[model samples]
Target: MVKEGLLDILKGNFLVSDEASKNWRFLLFASVLAALMIASSHQADKKVHHIADLTQQVKTLKSTQVKHKREIQQLLLESRLKEELAPIGLGVPEQPPAKIQIVSQP
Candidate 1:
């Protein structure tokens, strides 16, 4: 049965026959749709993997940003600066700073 069907397909008998021609067209359409579905699935998988990679990179960048932010916050602390400056004998001034005004000659 299968061999006869293959022989009929090879001899183009299906194209000339009314019932077989409809089946042939339907099979061809189905095959094309299957191919497109496979291609679309592959493309979707590629995009999913790309999005996963980007998500991981975003997480890494966020962690790095957080670490830098924490470091900056620690560095900006007055107690931390005071401790760091103790060796140099630098301390906050007790007096308010004076403003200096310069007069330009005309």
Candidate 2:
């Protein structure tokens, strides 16, 4: 009888009409598998949402950076132009840029 029961379990033939109280092992196994599938699906969906949100934020920051960089460059050009026109007293000369000279010692 015990060998037959063991073989039944090994064969995994837990039919729904089984009125046997000892048939809960198959139910528990199925329940755990179902729960695992649900949790993994939810986790994957969350990761996808997070990635999309991060991508949008990165795009926004990149556009903001580009705008600020363009404004800074325009300001620098205007200042240099004013300096060049300062000889006729339209503006004061701007300070010179820092220099790096590579000197060779023989």
Candidate 3:
């Protein structure tokens, strides 16, 4: 009996035999599992690519921020401020500022 079953499988007879109906549910289940596995793999690949893109964007933003910070530092320098204000007729005071004191009556 076992030899006949093996021969039936090798001859592709089992696929057309009446017993093949019993295997249809299991075959459908396996097919669905394979489809889900393929979909999961594709989703993981997309997430990896998205993360790489986000990482590159973060690096670009960081470099741009550093450049802007350097420009702001240069603009904040006293020499640079004086040079910019000089063109507008503004000059530094030569004498020190004075303060007045008032006495309160008791």
Candidate 4:
């Protein structure tokens, strides 16, 4: 199998080992290393995906913040305009716009 060949290539120490348990030791070591590599790669992919999703969320929040700021500015402008028109009675209503009062002379 491909796994066995790669495992043999990685276990260079096994070729020089004189002990009968050398094969078991080398295979176990190689298997552990390969597992670690696989786990690290999977973790790295998850981290990258999380970062990308966070970036998109940040962009969306930034856009929403800008829109809220614009709305606040517009409301402020409207309030100031209303204040300026208050003396001449152009916008706000102490009375209706079409209503007028006349005085009677004796």
Measured by TM-score, the strongest candidate is: 3
Alpha-carbon lDDT, every model: 0.95, 0.83, 0.91, 0.85
User: Tens-digit lDDT track for model 3 on 6-102?
Assistant: 9987998866778887677778889999999999999999999999999999999999999999999999999999999999989678888788889
lDDT digits (tens) for residues 1-106 of candidate 4: 9888688669865566576387778778999999999999999999999999999999999999999999888767978889877798788667667866898998
lDDT of 2 by residue, 12-86 (tens): 665443664456776788899999999999999999999999999999999999999998887689777787677
Backbone clashes in model 2, listed as residue pairs? none
Query: How big is the positional error of residue 56 in model 4, measured in Å on the Cα after superposition?
Result: 0.5
The worst-scoring run of ten residues by lDDT in candidate 3 lies at 14-23
Residues 1-106 of candidate 1: C-alpha lDDT, one tens digit per residue:
9999899989988777868768788989999999999999999999999999999999999999999999999999999999999899998889989999999999
Candidate 1 lDDT (Cα, 0 to 1): 0.95
Q: How well does each candidate superpose onto the true structure, as a TM-score? A: 0.64, 0.58, 0.81, 0.58
Off by over 4 Å in 1: 1-19, 83-90, 98-106
Best candidate (score: lDDT): 1
- Estimate the lDDT of model 2: 0.83
* Candidate no. 4 TM-score: 0.58
Preferred candidate (TM-score higher): 1 or 2:
1
